[model samples]
Target: MTKPANTQLTDARRGDARADRTTFLWTAAFIFAGMTVTILSAATELQRANSAFPVGKVVLYEITGFLSFLAMFPLIAWLVTRSTPGQHSWRQVIPVHLAASLGVVILHVSLFVLLRKALVPVFFGEPYFFTDNLARDFIYEYRKSVLAYGIVLFAITFGRELEQKRRELAAAREDAKKSHRLTLKCGGRSIFVDASDVIWAKSASNYVEVKTPGAEHLARATLASIERQLGDAGANAVRVHRSWIVNADYISRIEPTGEGDLKIEMKDGATVPGSRRYRGNLNLS
Candidate 1:
């Protein structure tokens, strides 16, 4: 049975919400793991160099830096989504991402500096100063920030593409399962119609008239809904008029009406009018 259009839309929204939640959780886990590794590595380097800085201070510094990037992560993701990677040329995408990367670097530096100034004094009883020279600090941070931005953009683009492919595969499997038959409730009786056996269908008031080689069935459904069912069933059906949908396999010949319309002749010896507006839908060749 075909679901109502509104119901299908609701289901799609629910699926999207669930996918979003899954992506968020996975991203958070990876970020946390990376932060832990980075902090430990930085602490080890300080120990190897015999630096005067405490391990706790090094960890705090790394945490603040990671937190700054974490704060800016959503904006990077939003920019990537807005860019619609594969849809636009590199010429268009490159400039937007470059400008966004600059913005991210500036924001990240400012955020982490502020965090360290606020938290360091409380923990160690001493003030924190990022640098005396702002220009040098920005240039130093810019390189790392750009690299981080690129990594994140690539990850998001790859994830979205993978999700799209997964959805397409699932849809193909579902269509395969329902491709052979259509269930219709007519006159308080349930009727099963083979998709291949359908010749044509027409909208009658609020209902649709489904025609098969063996029988005609009137079902309480809209022509648009019937068209969707036919498509999902993999039937070679095309809507040639506002009120008519004909199976291309049953169409023997198409005659020009000379009024910018067509007379469609079916193999079953039935005729249906085809609107000129829908002529592009037919494979005339």
Candidate 2:
């Protein structure tokens, strides 16, 4: 038999792609907004603490802060996508996070120093000023860099959890819409089969024997219940007798018996009994 169309599968892939794009854009926007907020807040604090602070230096400091996250957030995105968050223990994540934190701190400081050296010469007409105490400078900034890295990881984890929940909820609703289904016992397991695959059905005392092209399976429901449950799926199936229903699509021939009962021969060479009482239901072309 031919498999069903994959339109839903294609659409699901498209939806996933769209959702990923939206999440990525939102993450980038948050990082840029966060950097802008940090710059403004730093400028405010510096102005209050030192009224005579050089405006150019304060602007340079805040610009470096912006560039820092500009470099770090992409790395966070790559890390989040590559790793399963909760699968790693603190021992694994902490070391990786420490290494990343150090890398971003070094990049931030290096960019700031280089940019200041070039810009200060052109605009301030002097070399950028800094203390010779490199260790002290790095130690102070590394603390803040480590904290920011933790926050970045937290954001990625939270976003992933939200996306996973949304997918589960959507799948639940989709499952609810699938009503044309039957549960059958086959090979010692209860399997859900589409009613469309059933070529015939017969009664078996509080159960239904469902016949497909290649196999007969047992269903836990009564014949009447199975019939009603498969109502939407039985455009080709018709009740030919109180004991049997036949899929018209597989009807090879019908013949009248000398005993007045009708016989249904299926494409698979199986013959099913048909009562005269429901003979009108079998007006097949």
> Residue 237 of candidate 2: its Cα lDDT?
72
Each model's lDDT: 0.81, 0.69
lDDT of 1 by residue, 199-277 (tens): 9999999878999998999987678767776777888989999999999999999999997799999988989999999
Tens digits of lDDT, candidate 2, 112-169: 7777777777766778875589899888877876676676667666666566546543
User: lDDT (0-100) at residue 211 of candidate 1?
Assistant: 95
Query: What lDDT would candidate 1 get against the real structure?
Result: 0.81
Query: Candidate 1: deviation at residue 81, Å?
Result: 1.9
Predicted structure with the largest TM-score when compared to the true one: 1
Q: Number of clashing residue pairs in every model?
A: 0, 0
Enumerate residue pairs that collide in model 2.
none
Against the hidden reference, what TM-scores do the models get? 0.56, 0.49
Cα misplacement distance, residue 109 of candidate 2 (Å): 2.4
